[model samples]
Target: MELRSMRYFVAVAEAGTVSEAVKRVHVTQPALSRQIRLLERELRVTLFDRREGRLELSAAGRGFLPVVRDVLHRADAATAAAESLAAGRLVHLTIAASPTTLTDVVAPFLATFGPQDPLPTVQESSGPEALDRLRRGADLAIVSQQPPALWSTRTLAVLPLWAYVPRDHPWAGHETVDLDELAGQPLVVLDPTFRPRQLLDQALAEGGQALADPVECGNAQVAQALAAAGRGIAVVSDDPRFDLHGLRITQPGGDHLSITLHAAWDPGHHAAASLSALAERLEIFCRTRYPHP
Candidate 1:
């Protein structure tokens, strides 16, 4: 019945006598014998034949050996799996970010670091619904707000901002584009579905500037991918791996805006330590990838 009693029964069967197995199991002979008998009653079958102060297997016991071993194997495996996950043996980290963040900022960040970590394995997705995956339980999410809202109780941090532009669209010649220089340029933007786009739109509105025709992408990478293809200019984080030939992200208007890059986890509940280490490594990753310099 109970897993412990099953272990006791199996040990006694293997040891050939309760007197012998008690020492092996560090239990008193009487206690071990009682447990074995309890297991026999629970299973409603005689498991051992005792004669001449020795033990012999019963037909039912022999038939049940593999089944008991299997249950023990599974329980052992469950513990092993939990330990492996804690040690980062699997090295799987799931991340979600807005598309714009992915292409223009998060994309470069991952490119620079995702493949480098020992045992690093990553899964990525984006959009409001995807961020909700994190709320439900995802390892990491690269989203608009520096601190995500859906699960405020998670481990979150910030990322710096970069000025994005169309490759070879003239800003490339300049070291940086000022806010005023962007005055009349058409802006390729993240869809309003994300929070970062909301922030940009709000700032523009407060500054009393109406945007030019806003071409929207669900994520930054789509915009960045387009920019790489010479489709449009965008505002994104300035990660070191970001390319100008593909698109341009430079200092703008003598201002530095660090995007709210957040890394978070549920206060309670998470993968074992190895997986937790993966989370910590991700934090280090965001820092190295998005250094202010």
Candidate 2:
């Protein structure tokens, strides 16, 4: 029933064992375990099932997890809002986005803020978790996915997915390379959580093609590094790094392999108008900065 108990339950659920959960929650193993038991007894539902000394979420636990997470997020948001209000600035904002988007788009946009403008905080969130960050207190979420109904969203830009390679590579001189040809090569690609990977998966499925022995990396810089070392072409949407040349990915249908960035926010937020205006400015900035060749 207490918030601390909920925190302990979530920590145990994520860590999978009391020993590990104690390290995260900074509590003794016995205390954490007792708190979880008390929580389950109060709710009259077992939240976890112990099997082979491992703690796995029970059916009831899985159902209750989201509700608990939402509660914690709102609680955290309330704290942040109160702190911001106490500082005499109610216009503070937070943006949630992938690391690549944070570096390439949001950071640059923030650099244009003047003295009178409020500086926002940034949270590194992947494409799939962008909207969830809103519940976690982010004022804006920039991602490639379209948000559900009642959320305000705007198309920021359609950015090309690039195949990066060394300058000496055969594709270096070309402005574009077909997805089929790229798939045939041993490629370095980002993980499935990235927006570029999602788009790549869809394009490969539509073309009935599959990557051959592609090396999967979790970060764009690492993927580009592997490609630079002659590992293979790096398929990503990040800006060029490590002196690599990026070629646009083209499909057989003549359209480029690309991901459209969307700026999403809760329409009911207090700063909804400010977020919308910022999104519009970002759209204009992207259009001018990354104009089609």
Candidate 3:
């Protein structure tokens, strides 16, 4: 049966009458009725029971509806894929990442896209939840956690968490601050939802370090503002704001504290190559944007 006929059958089945279906399908009642009859003939089964000027789905029609819907959905997807191929790039994509990653990295990387590049939609997600976004229709996910074995993943960047302070602060002239040292100072920290904060928490727990009374805030910019106002050192990975100086946070083991960003996508995606290419590009962007000493 023709796809158009299948659509008409579904429309009639859903609308419960040819007259109502005609309004939806934008065809005359006779034309729609003829299409439905043609569809039933091609299928060699009655799709609808017509009685008392009403249309109701027959047993076969009910069984066929889901199959036809699946076919139509696949057909539309194929058309989109073909169009994207013709454009020589992805036409659109959706990326999932934490709010900080979205703000500090993905948002800036997206700004470099040319006119013909795929337009990206962003969803706020964190950690393992970012990978779950793929199942929810996100084309790509950027997460700090290692993705599942089945997913195609690339390391995008390893960005340092910094101890930010106003220029006049005592530690402002220092190139780095030990986690233990930072722990002993008055602190300005973003909430645990932020990746930097999560990493910081883990590092502190590992070192058995605890902060004295610290200021907690939700926004990175606001955290920097508090630090600029001399509340404490802002411990975050966000780009320096409010003219604050940032010192690389260090562990006693002589390692800088950092968060590693990974880009992940389903291997079975139709545009898997495009997604991988985009991930590689993001990696390169991050390397340049946040160079490590």
What is the Cα-based TM-score of model 2? Answer: 0.78
Candidate 3 per-residue lDDT, tens place, 1-293, comes to: 68888778878988999999998889999999999988888889998998899998899989998888777656655765897878876898889998889999999999999987888889998777888777656789999878888999999899898899899888778999888878988899988777788888889989886666789999888999999998889998889999999999889789999988899998977789999999999999999999876
lDDT, model 2:
0.87
Most TM-score-accurate candidate: 2
List runs of model 1 lying over 4 Å from the truth. Answer: 1-93, 99-123, 127-131, 135-137, 146-161, 166-168, 225-232, 238-254, 270-276
How high is the CA lDDT of each candidate model?
0.60, 0.87, 0.87
Candidate 2's residue-wise lDDT over 4-51, tens digit each? 998898899999999999999998988998999999999999899999
lDDT tens digits, residue span 164-212, model 1: 6545566666655555445466666777755656656666675687667
lDDT score at residue 228, model 2, on the 0-100 scale: 93
Q: Candidate 1 vs candidate 2: which has greater lDDT?
A: 2
